[model samples]
Target: MSKKIETDNTCNTSRRNLMKGTGLAVAAMSMIPAATATQAFAQTSEWDKVFPKSDKVDHQKVPFNNRYGITLIADLYLPKNRSGQPLAALAVGGPFGAVKEQSSGLYAQTMAERGFAALAFDPSFTGESGGKPRNVASPDINTEDFSAAVDYLGLQPYIDRQRIGVIGICGWGGMALNAVAVDKRVKAVVATTMYDMTRVMSKGYNDSVTPEQRGEALEQLSHQRWADAEKNMPAYQPPYNELKGGEPQFLVDYHDYYMTPRGYHPRAVNSGNAWTQTTPLSFMNMPILTYIAEISPRPLLLIHGENAHSRYFSETAFAAAAEPKELMIIPNASHTDLYDRMDKIPFDRIADFFGQHLA
Candidate 1:
């Protein structure tokens, strides 16, 4: 691992420092919700997505600027046969380290088939989107990514503008609600198989980590940051091996999904490398969705697989969210099952919820 980190110094330099402009500034700069900084993305015209192209929807690769001034790339899907009379539009993203070519694209394409304009976007630093320090995750910048999608949707001539909605899968589900709390432009929201990335990072799974443990974790990250400053590169942790033996069931599920043809994409972190080790530094202090109650009056729908280990994320988020919210659990779906299992995703329910609320 140390050998790889030493050898891959060029890309490793991007693991965290590229996003913040300077190594000394990452901790503070990343915490700011909006950035004045600009970045160039490596845009692609090739059809290299993980999922097969849909004949039912017309697709295009488009780019939009986020509140943070980072350019995010997205796949826009429109029903091939459009009525063209100001249709409702939706934006989709997440499962944490995933790019848009996996579950998010599937959801957007499915929604487009049901007569809504849909966009599945790569968040700030991941995928083909802009932002350097190749893998950095921020609770604040990520939440802003959703609102920027809303802003883009609102400006389209064929869209209703006022009928914008968002779906966040996995960690982004929690981010979707955070976007709604601040941007009332979003009339409805849906979060599927969600995880509050911050919650899990700070408190450990099931809120089992003690404050002392959290402090120790923070101290460890601090040392990592010092290492980052010393090496002039971010700390690195290799992703779990896709074909390794004797891993836990959930990790096996992840391996089957992201590392194989079932859902593999060249740009996904989970499909190859993991996030920058120091990326957790921001999540340690920034509690996202603290104002989830503010999302009330706006409709929210939470979906999770009944057997998913992360089901508690949706449960707690649903509990904290105000009126006009609904939670649905799929009988036997696991966390990774919802990433690509169309038959198990309950697209019908998603369509209905967005249809009614987005109307």
Candidate 2:
């Protein structure tokens, strides 16, 4: 059976930072319920401190269908008081295990304030989206999520169908690149703090998992599936960052955001629940970017923090892609910095990239 997780009332600071440049506050002022500003401020302290409020965009809830018939939820952001013609549209999603309400929504809303139509959507089986056996992932279905967003945007009256772009953050960054590889409708693509999910699941980070280790993982997953069938309950694993003493910096950074009020969203799997215990099997067997070179002619922007533990994923992907591609490294920033740190993320550069290509 399918179920939708109810969103928590906690106001995320990371989300607020992503919306700072958008004039959503002023436009939605009257629409906002009688919640006290003090309450809002207190609940949003971590996020607000990092990202000041923006009062230049309009935000609204939007629901659309994917090819699988799952009802995906998104927060649509549109620039306020724009001039001439309708502009290009952008569809953003990512960090895998996370909902649109977190970093992806922030990215969409921020870009919208920069004068593009942006929609950040929750992938199937997660967040407010409708799906059965929650927290499962598939390479094909996930890639289709991007295409479905494109389909929805193309039908919008205020959008230029021919000029559509996409931004994928973290794990979704890899998925977005995979989408652009085959979908010609994507005119430009930006992958921020990217992770190649296939590589990590198959070989483990930094190729720490040897062929024998990989085989053991496969055997474990296969047996876990049989156990799941017998028990009739989806196995759940806790977030990797919930480590104790002597954890790695990458895990520590993840904890600071996903596990705390600063970035937590109730619907985020990474913030709480683990995905299906058997998800590794598919991710291991599927290499998402085997045809990455085909994405040429359309521009690709790959951004990563120089110190990010996952920087190699973007470097390798950039090398795999053909011309009309660029790789930008943010000095001294970590993986999560690109998730919501506006000062660290090159928004102006991203805006310019999309504008040039989508034009």
Candidate 3:
């Protein structure tokens, strides 16, 4: 168990400061009936998800915009055997560069089967979402993306707005916490196989990058901006998830999921495409977990594999957070296993957490 910290007023003040530039305006507050929402967004009827469609949940494509007006495309999952009551709902996203078609969709569908409405969405500038200069990433905008999903879910007729929660996987887990810290509308949150993207980007893996190394990396990125300005377009790195040889075990794990038949999708960045050369510029200085303790009153569940390379992220996050938090570690499991492994994912415990909190 990670030691719980006492709430600090300074943390709350810092959280308020961070929220200044990341504010969101809910586009509409009126109820959005399913039929009208479906008509508003052009949805593909065909099942294109990497995970097989579940018979227990109704699935559909929907769109909603963030404060930046970047429209996000998402998959909505609802229980087939609904009792005609307003149901608790969850907004889901990430593993970061992966899309709604991969692990997020699987989590959403499985949660829907357990009796909550769930939405799995692509962050701005990725997958089928609407963002220009495709394949870019932003900590502020990406964290705002979750709140946007919450706004969309709260507008649905069948969803109980007060009972809404969030689930973030991989890198988005950090974003989820950042979002919830400010957007108090989310009643609970669960982050699995979490990665603090900003931390990794700024400090490098395991905080191994020296201060000199960090300065050099920033210098390179700054210069790349000049090249991008000259070309009138950001240059992309080579195709992602390619195994050249002698890669780290974690990279191998990522390749196995994104490059093989197991989790491959044409639209996923991790599957094949690449992010812009300057994508790290925004995340480098923007620490997303600076105010993690502010989510104290709202319960948080952090789930990680015992052997996951990213486990330290969740442990550290857990220690930083205030009370009403729990860190669950699945024995002998790797980070990617929680992405899709039903046995290791601990869906039952997740449902129990939301069930207790959202009720």
Candidate 4:
């Protein structure tokens, strides 16, 4: 287990400026009525757009419902010059709390540019998706979110149902693997900066949390459920850790992206309220990758940054899986670097992997 390192001077300066700025104030002031917060978060200004509209692909807003009846919203991207032929389809989601407007959409647009039809979706209960008591998480529901994406992609007119694939970023990487393990319809899978949410919830980073600590966490969540039911208020926790002076570079990198103008989205749970207090309980026991080995024969590509603190999750998953699995580590990159840093993220390798597997 890697010990939490102190934040450097540069990180401290950035964090301090960020907190003192209007961003923090806006986020804090949003804690009023839940309905108002939801509305405010849903508003996306032109300046907040992450990906420029692609002229090479046709884009449309599509909706589909999961078994949970949560209406999952997705932006479908299709190549304009498909020549009326069905192309391989890629479904993407993640970085956990992020909406499709961020990394996922970028990936979808790029993949479409590379001749694949793609759909980037907001997981159930987040972004444009419909679910009550906003900003919630569920292991089963989140896992199902990927399958719902696959379902939507498989039925698309420009997509070859048999050549469907998935790309999961950050925490969604775990969900993608879990989805492929069960769906069998996903011909290939790519997990970037993957995180096993179950492992993190149960053991903390690098398994620092002891067994007793895990039990205590579960206990607290159980009690919080009762409190939430009684109060009729949404159970929320603060962000994982505040950016303070002398924190680790990885922590600072996360803060720079998720907590700042670089990646902040009003609908993002991590950007605003913490996830549901009870969310960790589901993650604690629901090991999403236990069946990862079963995904073999179907290719799995695990990409991680060499310097990413959470790289071990992908390493461990790669070791657990069977043949036809490849692990690529990008040099000098940290966990969040792969999120949106196009130059650092090995898009060529990703394109080759999908092209080969989906062929």
If ranked by TM-score, best first, what sequence of candidates would result? 3, 1, 4, 2
- Winning model by lDDT: 3
Q: List the lowest-lDDT window of 10 residues for candidate 1.
A: 1-10
lDDT of 2 by residue, 1-359 (tens): 11111124332234213323332111111122221111000111122222344578877778899998988877778889767587799999998888777888788889988899999888887777767777777888888899999999999989999999999999999999999999998899999999888877776665555576566667766777777799786565444346576655676888898888878765677775566666666788899989888988888889988677787788789888888788888877888989888799889999998988888
lDDT winner between candidates 2 and 3: 3
| Model 3 alpha-carbon miss at residue 185, Å | 0.2
Put down candidate 3 lDDT per residue, 58-139, tens digits, no spaces.
9889989999999899999999999999999999999888989999999999999999999999898888898868777899
lDDT of each: 0.78, 0.76, 0.82, 0.76
Q: Per-prediction RMSD in angstroms?
A: 11.3, 13.0, 10.6, 7.2
User: How far off is residue 111 in model 1, in Å?
Assistant: 0.5
Instruction: Give candidate 4 regions above 4 Å deviation.
Output: 1-48, 239-242
* Segments in model 2 whose C-alpha atoms lie over 4 Å from true places: 1-53
lDDT string for model 4 (1-359, tens) is 11122223222224223222222121121222222234324433343446578789888788899988889888888888887888999999898778888888888888888889989998877788888767776768989999998888777776789999999999899999999999999999999999887777666666665566566656666777777799886656555425758765666887788778777766676665455555566676778889999997898888887667778788899888888888887776778989888898888878898998889
Instruction: Report the Cα lDDT for candidate 2.
Output: 0.76
Please tell me which model should have the higher lDDT, number 3 or number 4: 3
For candidate 2, list the clashing residue pairs, or say none: 13-47, 20-54, 22-56, 23-55, 23-56, 23-57
In the predicted model 3, the residue pairs found to clash are: none
Q: What TM-score would you give candidate 3 relative to the actual structure?
A: 0.88
| Candidate 4: Cα lDDT at 311 | 81
Best by the TM-score measure? 3
